[model samples]
Target: MQDHTVISSLIVRVLPDHGESAAARLASIEGVEVHEKLEGKIVVTIEAPTVDSSHDTAASFSEIPGVIGVDLVYVNFEDDPAVAKGSQR
Candidate 1:
């Protein structure tokens, strides 16, 4: 079976004093990447095997201690093939 891959970008707002810590925590998540952090805003990306997983990952950001908001900025989905079938003899 093939699995769908979902990629998404989010803008997270945190308390100014906690931005650094928040970024660190976000970067720790399995498929999350913290691209930029300035003032109280953080730009991040999350990649998961499914749309539901992506949403769950994004929602997890909102549960972080200093996170004030999570706004999804972009999303993309692609199918992953289960196996390669090219052969020649």
Candidate 2:
């Protein structure tokens, strides 16, 4: 088996079904970390054991009432075959 990992960061710009309260609600999800807040958006970072987890976290954010959309600002992974694929030395 191969290990798959991913790090995802999203800038959620909320139209806010309930203003800051909406943002607050989204911040409550597990494994989701709030990196910053500016204007009407919250920046969140999610680290998961796999790509699916990362996407699941994003979906959670989208389920929030105030969430207008999620802008993926950053994503990095360590499973690329070219860089560290077999560098086990």
Off by over 4 Å in 1: 1-4, 80-89
Q: How close is candidate 1 to the true structure, as a TM-score?
A: 0.81
Q: What TM-score quantifies how close candidate 2 is to the native fold? A: 0.73
RMSD of each: 7.2, 5.3
lDDT at position 82, candidate 2: 36
Please give, for residues 36-76, the per-residue lDDT of candidate 1 as tens digits: 99889999998788777888899888789889999989988
CA lDDT, candidate 2, residue 72: 89
User: Candidate 2, residues 1-89: lDDT per residue as tens digits?
Assistant: 33446778889988744547766786687667787777788888877766667787888777888788888888886754433555665
lDDT of 1 at 47: 79
Q: Would you estimate the TM-scores of all the predictions?
A: 0.81, 0.73
Q: Which candidate is the best by lDDT?
A: 1
